[model samples]
Target: MSPAKAPAKPVRILLAKVGLDGHDRGVKVVARALRDAGYEVIYTGLRQTPEMVVDAALQEDAQVIGLSLHSGAHMTLFPAVVSELKKKNATDIIVFGGGIIPDDDVEELKKQGVAELFTPGTPLQDIVEWLRKRFPSS
Candidate 1:
């Protein structure tokens, strides 16, 4: 008989709200969805800086950092987080975001190293499945 398959790795994702963006409703919802989907989620409360977010992600040993922004500062905050990650020599930790980012800036963000960006209506299941695909078990 064939051996049973190994359990999939539990993806550890750190979710955060950076800078003066006080909005938390959406990030809270996403955190719950990811938890229900069986991923370890760390939701750092509102008013965090890019450095604080990166530091927490590192301390938590998270594989991914999910930043949610609605303050229209995606252009600044997102890249700052990515830069902090690079500065800390934690490039392996992937970064993703969701918010009111303009479509025009998507490519630039990607070039600056953001892995994905979900618009307002992106299905939670899509987020779950995407993480699964990104961190499939051996």
Candidate 2:
């Protein structure tokens, strides 16, 4: 019989609250959930600019970038984040978002390359499962 294969490393995710959004209770909860689920989470507190978010993700070598938005700036903020990631040649990182984003904007954000949207009330396990499937390291 062949030797057993080793389990893959947990995905590293950077969770950020960008563009002056001061309410981070949701992001904090999700960050803890991701950590408990075995992901290495780098939480970039509140009021981060898009550039800062990308920089931190790059510095941390994160495989995923999760943005928590609630300031009604998803339209401007998400695109700005994506654009900065492109400029830095870091577009390979899977980008996801969750917040009070409207349905139309969620579609538009997905079209702009957001991997998924975790709206209010989304189960925490759903996010973890999605990441594990999308970024399995084994």
What lDDT does each candidate get? 0.90, 0.89
Give one digit per residue, the lDDT tens place, for model 1 in 1-138: 996543466778999998788889999999999988777788889989999999999999999999999998899999999999989999999999998888888889999999999988889989888888898761
Q: What C-alpha lDDT, on a 0 to 100 scale, does residue 123 get in candidate 2?
A: 94
Q: Show pairs that collide, candidate 2.
A: none
TM-score of each: 0.91, 0.91
lDDT of 1 at 91: 97
Candidate 2, residues 70-109: lDDT per residue as tens digits? 9999989988999999999998998999999889999999
Clashing pairs in 1: none
Model 1 earns a TM-score of 0.91
